[model samples]
Target: MERILEPELMDDEQHALAYAQADFVEVNRGFVDRFRTTFPDLTRSRVVDLGCGPADVPVRLARLLPALGVTAVDASAAMVRLAREAVQRAGLGASIRLVRARLPALPFASSTFDAVIANSLLHHLAEPGVFWHEVQRLGRPRAGVLVMDLCRPASPSHARDLVETYAGGESPLLKRDFYNSLRAAFTPAEVARQLARQLPQLTCRVVSDRHWVVSGRLP
Candidate 1:
């Protein structure tokens, strides 16, 4: 399927709120759980979450590892705004730092974080190489990397089925966005090839029917 790029940043207030209010608790919890389970020895004091939409993953992770601090980065101003409130509501203001920065152009030095993670962030990018580059550039030596994202469907009918199944109750705008995301997402094999060229240390695999997970430690 040809990639149709959607708006890169979810900057609008009502739109961002629609995404923030979307019921992704289970999916978010799964991302956190899988990260912990896969990297059982991940004892990093500092971690970075790229494209932290609603701070759901960051909040859950911070609460799990009380000693761990998270730097949550998102390109959308409204996303960061809502995330601030969510973080405060969870009383995790001290544990998580929210930064409004566009992906592939983060304002951080090399090896700045002990670990890096992103959820459903890749499909939104037109230059995924930038994401891969920043993952290595910003991560500490052998920094743990955990990334999860939707997988592109084989056909339009399949994509529509997924939307109907998963986003049946979501608002029309949000549902359209979700469908566009699925259309833009890459398959596991495609992502693996990208990793091989830029970040051989990371491994990509299909983790669920709708998602692909790329994870490993920086070499």
Candidate 2:
């Protein structure tokens, strides 16, 4: 299936609210766990999460690694607000900093982060190469990087099946968004090619029926 582009940012209030309220406990936890397992020697103190929707992963990472400082960035104001509330509720205001910024042009200086992580963010971009470049520009040499996102299915029917199988109980808005995301997602092969041109050190693999992950350290 050809990739269908969705809106780059979930800036709409209702869309953001529905996405923030949706149950992603297992998925988010798995993402954090995967990062920890992939980079067990992650001794760096500075970490940044791009497209940190609701900040659940950031909060979880902070709780798991109390010494590390997390900077979570999202383009959507509503998502940033929701993330702030989540961080405050988790009593991790000091450990996690929430920033509202668009991608491919973040405010941070080059090589500012020890690690760069993003979840479910790649498919939103029309020019993913630029996003990869930004990730490369932000991370210091040998910095850990883990990016996970939906994998485009073989057909639209498969996409709908995935939505039904995984997000059947979610709200209508959430379900619709999931479908659109699946449609917008990149295949593992395509992601691998992108990494080859922009982040050759990274490894792209299909981690699940609907997800692919690119993980490794910067050169």
Candidate 3:
């Protein structure tokens, strides 16, 4: 199936509020655990989180590693506002720095970070290569990269079933966004093809029932 493009930024106040109020602890905690396991002994590392919505994962990660410095970047103004509030609440104001920058065009220097991670941000891109290219451009040599996103279901029925099963507790508006995001997501095959054609150095794999994790060391 062809990919559908969704809004790139959750700048809308209602959308941002829904995202901030929504419970994503399970997913965010899992991401932090996965990152810890994957990059063991990464103390005092400088990491960049692209498309960090409300500073969820980045805040969790900062708590996990107090020495770690995180540059959490998002394109949405509302998200940035909420993220600042979250970081302040988490008392990680010193560790996690929030930046309002769009993907594929970060304001940082090339090859500047020790690691780069993006969670569930791929499907929002109409041109996925721009993100992949930025990963290489911003990551220093041997920098770890982890890009995870939802996998598009084989059929629309499956997508709906997923929404009902996983997001049944969410409000109707949030569920609607989830369903649309599923439709916009790329399948594992499509992601693999993009990896082959655009970022051969990185590896892509299905990490969960509904997620694909693309990760490797920058070449």
Candidate 4:
């Protein structure tokens, strides 16, 4: 299926609130677990999470690796606000720093981060190559990288089926957003090609029925 672009940022108040309230416990936990397993030596690295909606992954990672520092960034003001609240509530305010910034133009210096991670962020970009380039630019040589996002279905019917299968109990707003995101997601082959051109050292693979992941260390 051809990709249909969704809004780049979930900036709408109602939409952001609904998204922040949605249940993503299982998937978020899986992402953190996989990251830890992929980079076992990264016990005390400085990590950056791009498109860190609500900051759940950062909180989870920080909890798992108390010695690590996490910098979570989101372009949407609403997401940033919600993420800050979550960090404060977790009492991890000192371990996780929240930044309001967009991809392809983050404020950090090149080779500053020990690790670069993102969840469900790539599909939101209109120019995904630029995002990959930014990831390469930000991480130091041999820095660990892991990015996970929805894998575009073979057809629209498959997309709806996924929505019902995973988000059947979600609010209408959340359901609609999920459907849109599924439509907007990229295929593993496409992501591999993007990485080949912009980040040849990374690897891409399908990790689930509806998800694909790109993981490896910077060269």
Give a tens-digit lDDT track for model 4, residues 52-99. 999999999999999899999999999999999999999999999999
Collision count for each candidate, in order? 0, 0, 0, 0
Q: Positional deviation of 46 in candidate 4, in angstroms?
A: 0.4
Candidate 3, lDDT over the whole model: 0.89
Pick by TM-score: which candidate is best?
4
Residue 168, candidate 3: Cα error in Å is: 0.6
Q: Which stretches of candidate 3 lie over 4 Å from their true place?
A: none
Candidate 1 C-alpha lDDT tens digits along 1-219 = 766777788898988998999999888899888878887777556899999988999999998888888999998989999999999999999999999999777888999988899998998888899899999999999889999999899898899999999999999988988899999898888899999899998888887889999989998
Query: Rank by TM-score, descending?
Result: 4, 2, 3, 1
Identify the candidate with maximal lDDT: 4
Q: Candidate 3: minimum summed lDDT over ten consecutive residues — where?
A: 1-10
Q: Give me the overall lDDT of model 4.
A: 0.94
Q: Can you give the TM-score per candidate against the true fold? A: 0.97, 0.98, 0.97, 0.99
Please give, for residues 1-219, the per-residue lDDT of candidate 3 as tens digits. Answer: 556778888899998898788888888898888888888857689999999989999999999989999999999999999999999999999999999999777899998899999998889899888988898888999898888999998888898999998889998878988888999999988888888887788888987878989888887
Ranking by lDDT: 4, 2, 1, 3
Candidate 2 — which residues are off by over 4 angstroms?
none
TM-score winner, 3 or 4: 4
Off by over 4 Å in 1: none
lDDT of 2 by residue, 1-219 (tens): 999999999989899999988888898889999878988888556999999988989999999888889999999999999999999999999999999999887999999988999999999999998889989999999999999999999999999999999999999999999999999999999999998898899999887898888999999
Candidate 4's displacement at residue 37, Å, is: 0.8
Higher-scoring candidate on TM-score, 1 or 4: 4
Error of 1 at 132 (Å): 0.1
